[model samples]
Target: MTSILIADPIPLLNKGEQALLEGIVESLNIIFSKPDIMLLSNYPEKDARRSRIPVINRNPVLFKSIKKIMPRSAFLLEGALMAILARFGKQNFRRLFTRSELWQAFLNSDIIVVGHDSSVSYDAVIIGWLLNKPLVIFAGSIELFRNKLKESIAKVLLKKVNLITLREDDSYKALMDLGVIPGVKTQVTADAAFLLKPCSPERVKEITQQEDLPVHDRPKVGVTLTRQMCERSHQEINDVNERYKKAIAEKAIVLDEIIERYNVEIVFFPHCIGPGKNDDRLVARDVIQLMKRKDMVKPVVSDLGASELKGLIGQQCEVFIGERTHSVIAAMSQGIPSICITFPSDRRTHGIIGGMICQRDFIYNVERLNPIELLTLVDKLWAERPVIRKKLEGIIPLVKERALNSARLIQTIVSEKEKSDNGYRCPSSQH
Candidate 1:
């Protein structure tokens, strides 16, 4: 069997990350002949319970404690030392330095795959490179590093990667700016979530009833919120809390106006539940609590899986106004018209929504957020939804094919590795 390791630690609480992992796993299963797969997850026990595949904690307790104390430079230096020890030390020392099970999985794996959605991490890349493992980064939207140390590190580590399939043009451009050579090693692909299959209609209905979403005759407008959406950059604000509350209040007023003007039910999709204050559920609650038309608003408070959430949105929503990138992607994939609420730092919205899907008009900047402007955009989106939906129907299939192509590219990398290593044999074939 070809043992494959996904290096990123997926947290099920973040449905976008879950969607990426699910799509990648589904694609890999279809591409490979029952390949042995394992996940490195943040919530390993929970993920293991949900998935048939073996799950290991990406950050073990000891490592987590160590990272908390160590400065980033010191931490990275320690990782380098450990990698070197793992590469050249005695068996016992290697086991000690590599941190047991995590490194053991790294050593046993034929290929190391990193799924980068909104952000990029270089931990897996560094270790995988040191171990001489074939590494592929798929469906990534890599941002240009503002910090020089991170930029330098990215340049050094990324060059060693076997393949890098970016999800957006901005990421590709960022890679070029970082001086990573493109073409075969780097290619732009659509997000893996684009290929994620929604749950059955029956399951969707079950989730709808379970969440106690309104079953009224009015058209439903799906909305996704995040704490970040109500935040401005620290440079722009003195009192963050005050500004956030003000933003929430402003949003509440706008949503109330939207309800009254359009006679639409606003369904808040909690795209990310929590790890902290970043929870969409909390943000939605804050907005809903301040709104006058509470009866017209419903928040999906249940911690549902990515496919289930996608199904609910696809079946129920006529228009989506989403702060979460994947929520917008999910809605757009289903041929539903969506307005993307984007932060200044978010490259994904412009690159994916504007560049790929050609819906630049519907993307609104959160920094310069105006309630009247947002309401106007919503009105325009509502009016032009049919045409937008039609455009998406024409474009989404091609984008989905690109998403599937990422998996095919992985197969090619694996095939090339097999060809180059004559002494290596599949464990299943050996048996």
Candidate 2:
């Protein structure tokens, strides 16, 4: 059996990452002939073929404790906002985030697959380069888009790697222009997480049972928000807030109206529950409070497990407006159409829009947002979805195909790594 390793820095995953990782591990397990897969994550689970190998960390109990603290996570997320503020103020608050064991785990892996934007992969990429491991990456806005410096590092990292599994043709071509060679050796694969299986209707009914109300009776709506644009200078913030404030205001306005107009019950879901200003829980809290009535709306605040969240998304919710990339992905996989909101530079917008393949228009760009226009588009989409959904059924297979291609890449990587270990010639460095 070919052995492979998964390096995820954020040990305690928020819903989307967990679902993505699960699909990757399970698909590879089968395709690679039930390979012995070792995963080094902060939160490990016990499963059959895959072993959640624990890394050396002092006080696992404390780490677990820190993970469950929702408010604290929001506050810590604020530190990222602070850290960004510090970039301007020159404060350097990032030294607190380094985990020595994360890299140590990377050193032990045959291939290291990392999502973008985590401080863990920030170092993991370098470690892979230093160790000469086949470094495979699937990055875009969901992991936060790269800035100039990150782009620079990503360039070097992409070059140093044995293979580059890009998420989109745009990103793939960008790399190719910067000297990435494409062939069977270096392929453009889908976001491996897109292979996620939707929750069955029965499974969906089971998870929401704890919520009590009959599936049809509950007015279920999914809401997600990210405050990255808000952490900027007041002028920049105001510009974005003005553009999006109306959209947020409109979403609130429309949602408030939807609650009244449709007698719908809205459920706010915090996609990224990390520290301070970036804390989605706080943003959800802010939005919930901003809306008039607490009785008509609810926030599922438990930091749910992946399966639980996926089932929730699949449940016959009237609508799910995705504020995060994975939220849209989860919704689409479940045959639920979503209105995706993104910042100007969000790579995820392109990723999901591409996934939609013009089958169903489910994207809303937040930078140049016009709430009234967006609301108009939402109206048309809402009215047209029955027809739109049929279109989705046709394209779902294409999206699913891309996801399987990602698994193909992982299997190929594992095979190539095995060949290297057996002292075969290195897979001709086509990339």
Where model 1 places Cα greater than 4 Å from the true spot, the runs are 46-52, 60-99, 233-237, 422-431
Go through the candidates in order and give each one's C-alpha lDDT. Answer: 0.81, 0.55
List, residue by residue over 365-396, the lDDT tens digit for candidate 1.
Answer: 88888898889899899899889999999999
Q: Residue by residue across 47-161, what tens digits does model 2's lDDT show?
A: 2112233333221232344546653353233323332332333323322222233333433456666543222244445544444567665432223334877666655655665
Candidate 1 clashes: the total is 1
| C-alpha lDDT of candidate 2 relative to the true structure | 0.55
Best by lDDT: 1
Provide the global lDDT of candidate 1 against the true structure: 0.81
Worst window of 10 by summed lDDT in candidate 1: 422-431
Pairs in clash, predicted candidate 1: 1-428
